[model samples]
Target: MCAEALALLRQQEPWFVSLAILGALYVAAVAYRLLHTSGLALCLRGPKDLRRRYGAWAVVTGPTSGIGRSMALELARRGLNLVLVGRDPGALQDIAGTASDTHGVLTKTVQFDFSLVSTPQGEEAMGRLRQAVERLEVGVLVNNAGVATPHATYLHEADAEAWVRMIRVNLWAVTEVTAAVLPGMVERGRGAVVNIGSGAAEALPSYPLYSVYAATKRYVSQFSRSLCVEYRGKGIDVQCQAPLYVDTKMVTNMVTRGGLLSRLIMPTSDAYAGAAARWIGHRRPVCMPNLGHRLQWCLCHFVPDRALAAHRLRENLRQRAVFQLLRSSSGEGIGGRR
Candidate 1:
């Protein structure tokens, strides 16, 4: 009887250990999924109406064109005072003038190259911005300046310096501006931040040339969520808006020459801007402009790695075809003059 019992115990031990290991993995995966899903869900919720309780000012970077310009216009329409930042003094002045004349709101234009935000001069520039807004009672910050590069084989080959510049503008500049305004907002107990992220941050396919850009955006996605968590209870709202290809000069150029695939996924910048405005007012942590994009994100969350990779490869090929067509229609080959 004792010998028989020992044999049974030995057999059962292996099965028990295997079960334990499987259970541990399952728990870990579930925990990770839950955390990721929850964080992002929070980002999708829009900003609270702190404006009614406390009148607000909005600072928008890259306000010269595209979504940034649209956001500036929308904010001004709401009777929010504006501090418009961009590299083009002429364009910035134009935007400020339009906002002031049309909306009857105070508008200040600061001309500086946000591409240099990681440098000492950039720090000084930001300081000047702080001084400019010191008396305006700023309550909202929009980090919207960004740039993208055409695809390249080697990451180092695609103007490594420009990649660094993009990082400074897209990632570091947002961080600096947010940090600068945070204390003031916190002290006042009311503020909001809107970070413009890319749908490419979802890690979908056919963005070989945009790997670095995507990676930086992914950082923004995570950072925005984390900031939301840290600042939610303090009457501060941090939100990220990720949109698919917008019908701005950038995407217009891409689509005109790019193949059919580019046309299929192209979205309008105004649409994205409108969605962002609504989300900001609502205090959503993150907003996806397109319903299709939301579904894609959901699918990516649970799909197997191998299957996802294959799907992305196909999409890349389609995108490449569109890019090729765009180049041809523009009367140039790839790498030719625009």
Candidate 2:
């Protein structure tokens, strides 16, 4: 076996050398990015640098809960004022007040429902949203408001209303919100745009049951990349962060029932948001800021697509079972998507 392997290696010596060189370059590039965007990099920057680099004010949607809320607080902690957007007026107000009290940063609330985005009135609302922010020196825009399927459903059997809402929140909101903020950033010649996506979109092979949600996330990744290219030299940075599960309400059910591995894999929303914030000035078009998530992203590239698909299918089935059990035990119906 050794003799035959040696003979084959000699025959493909040039090919092997080329592969080795490519692999080395790939490793070097990844290492550089990892180090540059790591938590250590964040430590090197002063709070004043964040305010200066991204601007004085940051806009965050879905700022009432989950990763969105955590990210908003992170920005406030960095000494940036905040524009908090969400459907709930009271919730938005509460967060705004908290940010003001805790971080001593200015905060404003914008009440808007992404669910109605497809309606004419919703378009007008979005227009107003854009108009409202166009005058502000908005430095950072966090397009974090999004909806995922409540549970994995086959595309053929997916609920139409759910589909529309998910699309409106996940895809349309990103476009509208970014459009709302981009022009101001361009005018000022400096800004950062963070589009929050999911691992399902960029890391997994194919999300079989959550097809539409995954597709929307993929669109976010692609959109962020293209926008970055368009604005790269112009001084605006666009980034899509495709993260794995975070300890948010969206995954509360899974987190409660999942094993140790699942819990370990999903960082708390605060943890994930802090890591993501560190990557803002890294200039990378896409980021999976969590070290564990980065490893998963790399492994998914090497794994066979079909095998990954099978594994996802199995996981979806398990999640479905859990949902069914919860529904049966509690009189409450399915939970809303985040």
lDDT for each residue of candidate 1 in 273-314, tens digit (9 for 90 to 100) = 655666663455676745445655666768776787676556
Evaluated at residue 255, the lDDT of candidate 1 is 39
Model 2's TM-score against the true structure: 0.86
Query: Cα lDDT of all candidates, in order?
Result: 0.73, 0.84
Best by TM-score: 2
Query: Which numbered prediction scores highest in lDDT against the true structure?
Result: 2
Error of 1 at 10 (Å): 47
Off by over 4 Å in 2: 1-48, 255-263
TM-score of each: 0.74, 0.86
lDDT of 2: 0.84
Alpha-carbon shift of residue 180 in model 2 (angstroms): 1.2
* lDDT measured at residue 3 in model 1 versus the true structure, 0 to 100: 100
User: Looking at candidate 1, what is the lDDT of residue 188?
Assistant: 84
